[model samples]
Target: MKNYFYFLFFFLIPFGCDNTKGNKLVEKSTNDSSSIYLDKAQKKNIKQSEKLKYYKKSFSILKNQTNDSITRSKLFELTKELYKNNFSEDFLESANLLTTLSTKAKDSFYLAQIHRSKGNYYKNLPNYDSSFIHYTEAEKILKKIKNNDGLSLVLINRSLIQFDTGDYTGADKALNSAYLISKKNNEIASLYAISVMMGLTSMETKDFDKAIKYFNNGLEIIKNNNNLLGEFNKETCLNNIGLSYQKKEDYKKSIDFFKTALKNKSIKSEDPELYSLLIDNLGYSYLKTGNLDEALKLFLESLKIREELKYYNLIVLSKVHLSEYYRQIKDTSNAKKEITEALFIAKKKKTHRDYIAALKQASIIDVQNASTYSKEYIRLSDSIRNVEILSQEKFARIQLETDEIIKEKDILEDKNRSLLYTFIGVVFLLSMLFVVRAQRARTKELMFKQAQQRANEEIYNLLMAQQDVIDQSREIEKKKIARDLHDGILSRMFGARLNLDSINHLDDPESVKKRLEYLNELKEIEQDIREISHDLSREKQDLINNFVSITTNLFEEQTATHSAKLTYFMDSSIKWDLVKNNIKINVFRILQEGLQNINKYAKANTITVNFRKENNELHISIEDDGIGFDVSKKSKGIGMQNMISRAIDCNGKLDINSSKENGTKITLNIPLE
Candidate 1:
């Protein structure tokens, strides 16, 4: 399983190199001693020792030379090819030389490649600590260069190291990180590889459900990416999912999955190892479900392939399976023979799980050595468990050291952020202080405006009283004139007419004509005086209903004072006589304040004021077409506030709506009742 991820990394994320330029440089360097020896080492007839010597000579010559782009490229390719061909000794030597050359040339990309190659070399050597160290170095370089693809492949390799050491938790962490990178970068191969490894690790941890889920995720990935590689991986994913179900004792379901995997025609020819594994799994599932004949046939077939392939670990497993199949049939003799062969191969290959399986089968089948096999089995199980614990500790220590380095970096970043926040906090405090002082000054200005408004209101009230007095005086004068015209002048006219009528009774023709003319003239004078008296009486009634007139005068004054053209209308239905004095006074003041605000700040060309009575409520609206302000924002100015206060005093609601360049409208509604 580890080899699967390791080889996949090579296939999927090969080292990036400028092979064209490197080849051109090699052509140019054909006459150089290193190039000559390097070419000679590539010949098919060369001995293995001669080839190694020539390769060393080539590297030695280049190592002493001044490093350049051409030298770095050459060394990078040579080391990579050697690593791929499994020339461990020559690969390590050339990789070290390349590292030196790349470091001198400041070639981060090649440096990372060399470290990753060395990591694989150490991993193949089975030196996990050195492998981890080299991989960490490579990971750091890849992260610095922002090569997400390279980083993800490196993480997969690291997870393999952890997985081999029985650190399933650590392996899972690394694979999860690799999965995130592959998902983000859309690296399909890495996604498939990481998911499969994660499933294997979950299996090792005995989390069979999670293992099945991960295997299914791998299957989904392969299904979406339909290619030869995906089709090949599909069998493995199904095999793994089946194994997970088997671990949960669902043999029937697992047999179905195994049979489905076997349906792939190329699996036996192309991937015999996976084919053998699937058959073994299916045979075990069949054995669990009582199909002994089919189970024994599959066990023999898998053992034949595993032996043919010389896979000792798999051979040991196959023998153990056959041993179990023989024991299940109650053939104690054949079971002992198979178990003995399995134990010999398992011990030779150090295949612990196969060895344990064989030991347990031996104890079950051979009563004579049952106690001996059982004791050895117990000791070996404890030993493997202890070793697993130690490996887990080692992995935890490696992670702890890495975390300490990251924690130190985070601390430095936190300190920098703290300094930045402190500077921002200081600036915020200074701004707040300035704002507070400005607000205090604004408060004083508003207070002055409010005091001036009160004074103006007092002056307005005095003027209204004075106007009422003038109206009363005019009424008195008109009444006195009417009384004089009707009571004194009209009474005298009646008396004179009576005297004329008496004289007419004793008149001659000439005297009668002159008396008649004087009587007609006196009658005409009495009619004129009577009409004048009636006119004065009507004028007195006009003086009593003067509020409308006073309002009209105020509107006229606004038109005369401001540059803006003003228009106003007051509802005749208001019946001012019924309204309380306070309501009238506050309503008038509010209107006055509203108009004054428009004149002062509206900068409008047209202003309109309207008053209407609806449903026993008086409504006033003042509107201006001006550069409007946002009514949503709080204003420091007290003019609008004063108008609102007056409206509240009159038990009215005031609303102002304004938008930039749209206009402003102020409306107030007061209940008459």
Candidate 2:
């Protein structure tokens, strides 16, 4: 019943450290003394202080030498190495010196690199806004210079900023752009970085299979270029692959991958953090497989290491796993203890995802308080989803602003060329504009007709609703009449016949007496039949009479309650039976609404409603003599709209004519067919 927090795999985005190599700054000049210092600074088996000394010596030598390509290249290489090694003070000093030299040499390429390196610096400081600004500036320069490799690397850096801000979709878009550029330019290091990033992005979106595929792609790339990824990088890929499989619930495969990652003996000492993660994941897989003993052992080992390192988030994760393990073993007390501690740490860290996880585990183990925990979990989960959506929108806005900045620069550069084509472009646009306007007018007409049709269908449903009620009442009346005829009239006639027969069997005197009584009974039955026949005829007439009665009542109400005088005419030649029920319903509704409108708005002294049959078409006209307003100018009210819709529903057309101080006339014509 309890859910546990899954271990989050850590994937490091490699920002192409290999790209720093093969600097053109001083590579051509082997005779320069600075080259020797540069080579020594790149050696792996060196102390930070020693590397700093060599870089400083190269900078000093190159400063005194002539500012030729060799001198400038050597100085740039020294500055880049300092930046890479985290010699902040020395790196700043050397970069400032190189900035002056490169500007004097008019080197746009090196200048752009400085900006990119600064962006990385700010990104590590977690100042995403500043980092984004620097990346944008570098991108502009690279685009201008048409250096695809530099542009690709800058795009990757921008994507990392986006990723850190919880804008996974934006990050994916940036990564895709970078991937395309890097692949086209055959930039291996950039390609590897993009693949790893894309995989991590996929994992964030819960596409575990896609993530595994991308991770495998990274491994394949590493296989071909051993120098592209170190042993630790390879270990990351394996761990991530394991995590993806775990998410997919393929526990056995996850265990295999996690074990393979843990096989690196030096991981425990070299990267204790990654080692803890691997073991915890392996333990969780064991828990899922019901291997309680091994699961508990690995869980405790991972928890102890995380505690030593004081990683709050990791500690919470381990406790959650332990809670799940305890719950599996039916050890409720221990499960409660572990989950409570995990929940406390998660809340203190304000780690929303982990907090939600802890809450879910709490709900399952602590049955008495499960409802409260579950409510909080749902609330936090919804809040985090909304926040992530907003974060994505914010990052998208930042990218848009950056694009606008570049677009402005391009506009300035293309100003003259654009001017040359403006006249011809304007002529073409004018022609297209006329065509578009005509098409849009036609589209609007079609849309209006469609809307009217929908309204007609809706009115038809309303009419059917009324018809259903009437038909139900008529059916009930018919049933009552049938029962009376069968039970009362037919039964009495049958009894009278039997009586007459029984009399005939007796003496002539008794038979005459019974025959006289039978005649009297027959007379009474004949009266019942006559009354029933008349009732049936009346019921049949009510069908057509229903419409007339309703219209008459409407007109009477207006005359009795209002100041206006109402007059209505119905043509005797019009056969009510020939008209469809739907048409009758629509005409009755329209006449009713039109009279009400006259009473309310058309302060007319006389109102007339005329119904006539002409050439197989039914025409209804309502005229009001009140101070009539302009028909073309007045907006159609809801009542008028309904009237028009009903008219259209019956295959009819409505027309209205009115003028100031003149009577208003509305006419509806519907085909009888």
Candidate 3:
């Protein structure tokens, strides 16, 4: 939820190059001593073995050639093809040559393109720092040249890196910026890609409706294009949309989308990755929809392809899902084996998401065995979630540093301009003093008044700046605590779970029961760990939206506890993403205080939390059917002051309405963008 926007933006990058021709390249035998020629058969036969030789020759020729952007572009394309084929040496060499040629040609566009390609290479290598640098450089160049297409492309690429590196917020911003530019330029390919990304981000953030809308828009664009690859992308979007709906417990709609996505399989035989993904998604969908047989069959088919292709990551994911499926059908033995296998792979891969998933499956297995494995699963899940939280915080810190540098640069420039203007004014004043004494006196008085006003403004700005620094420090501390919880406590608990598992295998029944009880206690600890991890990772800004739900739940629980007739209504469909952590905490505290006030004074039997969004604004209404106070006559209390301050902190507004014999309604409106 913290980086929901970032997720949306990062998803758009692949679509930028969607217009490129399908994966078809010229091939030649490495051993064959034949002259290179551009022909249909030769182009169709391109192989990895010959890539280095061909790229080297092509790059050498292009380096010597002058006054030919078109030729240079073609050579760059060849280099990209080489890189795509995993010819690392050839790719780097060609990329370097292309960079030199583009620079000499003074072609900013091509330079940006070369940088983007280099960024892609580094990105695939998982060198996120280098990838981000290249992307930033390319963005600067594109912006300077006012090339919207180039800028959008760079933004998309940058977003991908951010998403991979856990900078979801940055990724979202980059993606949204690219989407606006693409829409303005009427770039269909970019638009479709952006749409897909938006859907993906929405799905990531658990906004099912938004995810569906984005996928639908992307499908519409792909349908209009009549492109096979676009269709493939559309299928992926549909699969994700279905998965999102499934997460929200909408089985009927999820099944519908999964079936629709499977309707196209023209290239499934040629693209194992695509085929495997589709099958796995379908299997998962079926599992969710209670179609055990269909789920098992699809999952098995997917596992086969994954094994053949040696896609270990996907294999781990599939195995865990299958384990869950088997467990649902009461096949405990098979479930245990599959889950154990998944755990081994997850440990080997050190992939946090996969590790957490495997642990979740293992926990289900523990339910049947009544063994310590459940504790182990919980421990591992907690550890993985903690690490994820730390990674997210690290990314946020890096972005903050980058932002600070830009702000400092702007301040320096402003100071320099002000100094230059002051110097010029002084010279003019001295030179014209005698000629316009009366006018000069008036000007001096005005300057005196302006200087006094400016001084006061500067003092006010300094105080605000100091407050901001303090807030930032607090945020950083919170992130540190979150990281510590994830890395230290969670990891130790997991280790404890492993120890408990060892105890469970002992022969003595007495020891086994003792170990099982210990494991159960650990399981509770693990649950607490997960809850804390999630809470820490959640951005403080999202508390505004979460408050409505939280308050509604509290009201319901209170009613049930007190045996009072209380009616509570909530929208339950409002979508929100946390923009910052500080905002989230403040909003949460404010809501807490409001609820406390209601419990003490409102004396209401019913409550309602209404949430709605209009463009860039968010609206929240909390009302209770209780004895209300007179707003005009009653003095403002500490709770009101706290709520007002919280609203001001987020640049939001709060309105409170109440009267004798009537319930109170507190409406909070916040700007989201």
Highest TM-score, which number? 1
| Selected candidate, larger lDDT, 2 vs 3 | 2
lDDT of 3 by residue, 573-645 (tens): 4444333544545555566666677878877776666656666676767787788989999988645876897
- Could you give candidate 2's per-residue lDDT for residues 44-91 as a string of tens digits? 899888888888888788878886666666666677778778888887
Model 1: ten consecutive residues of lowest lDDT = 1-10
RMSD of each: 35.3, 23.9, 33.9
TM-score of each: 0.54, 0.50, 0.50
- The global C-alpha lDDT for each of the candidates, from Candidate 1 onward, is 0.77, 0.76, 0.67
Off by over 4 Å in 2: 1-75, 89-106, 232-234, 263-266, 347-353, 367-387, 403-673
Candidate 1 structure quality by residue, lDDT tens digits, 1-673: 2322111212345454443322223324577787788788888887877877877787888778778866776677667666666678778888888888788778877788788887778887877766776787788777777766467888889988888878888888988888898899787888888988888888877898998998899889888885724446777788888888988999999999999989998889987888888898899999999999999999899889988999887777777778788888888788888888987887667667667777787788778768767876776677566666766775566555754534464564565467548645653564476468658867887789778877877776787678668877987998998998898999999899889988988659998998899899999999999888888888754444455666778788998888899888877677776677677778777777778878877799998989899999999899999988977785645666767778889888999898988889989999887
Using alpha carbons, what is the TM-score of model 2? Answer: 0.50
* C-alpha lDDT (0 to 100) for residue 432 of candidate 2: 72
Ranking by lDDT: 1, 2, 3
Worst 10 residues of 3 by lDDT: 1-10
Pairing residues by index, what is the TM-score of model 3?
0.50
